[model samples]
Target: MRIEHLAFNVTAPFEMADWYVAHLGMQIVKRGETGCFLSDKSGMLLELYEDAAAPALDGFSFPPATFHLAFAVDEVENLLRALVKGGGRQEGTLRTLPSGDRLAFVRDPWGFPLQLVSRAGATP
Candidate 1:
């Protein structure tokens, strides 16, 4: 079976949905008062749940040891610039792998780590 969707407990679901749409080119598949579902052109889905009571866990403040989401882009540097322009923060420097792939890490508006990688010859 293939992966369906990744869920995030965010403080502002609608804002997060808009951020993804504006920056990552995701579209809203469904929206509700407490949550929203978004999908990319390839049908990859993301679920965002609004949890006002959710504990604040900024990467720098709390340091989450959990998983991070990685997205493949045509160019890592361009995506990094887009992410910063869209209000996301670049956490670290961009690195090039020995395989000639580039990787950059950034934190979403709500502080979730996201890896942007060059999709030169990589397959889904």
Candidate 2:
């Protein structure tokens, strides 16, 4: 079966949703008092739920070090810059793979690691 959607437990659902919209170009498909669903128009969806009582955890604990979300972008550098302008922080420098693909990592406002991959010469 094909994948459907990914969900994130965020401290501020609306803010996180807005972050995705502003930085990643995701559009809000649905919204509720406690959560929101965003779509990138490519059959991929993201769900953000508010967690007001979430406990604070040390790094590499709650989310686990291996958990992360990746998104394909038309331009990795532009997206990385936009993410920083939108309050997200870049984790490290961009890298070009052997296949000539470029990738970069960034953390959302609440510290969710996200990978920005370049889809150069591909339609958005």
> Candidate 2: which stretches are off by over 4 Å?
51-65, 119-124
lDDT of 1 by residue, 1-124 (tens): 9989978777777887899888988899999888899998889889988676876334445332255678888888888998998888887689898888888888888888888888558853
How large is the C-alpha RMSD of every model relative to the true structure?
2.5, 3.0
- Give the per-residue lDDT of model 2 (tens digit) for 1-124: 8778887776778887887887778999999988999998786888888766875322234342366788888788988898888888888789998877888888887888888887655655
Pairs that clash in candidate 1: none
Worst 10 residues of 2 by lDDT: 56-65
Best by lDDT: 1
> Which residue pairs of candidate 2 clash?
none
Error of 1 at 18 (Å): 0.2
Off by over 4 Å in 1: 52-66
Ten-residue region with minimum lDDT total, candidate 1: 56-65
